[model samples]
Target: MSKRLFTTQIKLLESNPNIEHVSERAISYKPEFKLHAVQAYKSGRAPMQIFLEAGFSCYR
Candidate 1:
């Protein structure tokens, strides 16, 4: 995904407490969360896999 799209998606996931699809525009994220997710990915998890395991739903 493009940087813009990827950023928007990450923001949506951070803002939502439940697993749901986000159709809106860019969303916001806490700095701590962004750090955690990056750390998780660095610790041997696939990028998408980490988010999926964290309970964020992915839609096509």
Candidate 2:
């Protein structure tokens, strides 16, 4: 099977405050976002919920 490429719309993430950097293979989120995600997870928030709240999407 072919490897799935990271082809999400980079422009949409470029303006997100939670995002520190966007590259062809990965996304770098800000430290604050990392903390927030962890806290949210501990608080029982779903992973998808945390991502959506931080302006991230799983769809391509």
Which one wins on lDDT? 2
Provide the lowest-lDDT 10-residue window in model 2.
1-10
Cα lDDT tens digits for candidate 1, 20-58 = 334454445456657778998888888788667666677
Q: Please give the CA lDDT of all the candidate structures.
A: 0.61, 0.82
What TM-score against the true fold does each predicted structure earn?
0.52, 0.80
Runs in model 2 lying further than 4 Å from the true structure = none
Q: Candidate 1 — worst ten consecutive residues by lDDT sum?
A: 18-27
* Model 1 score (lDDT): 0.61
- Candidate 2 lDDT, tens digit per residue, 3-60? 6555666778777899898776777999999999999999999999999988777656
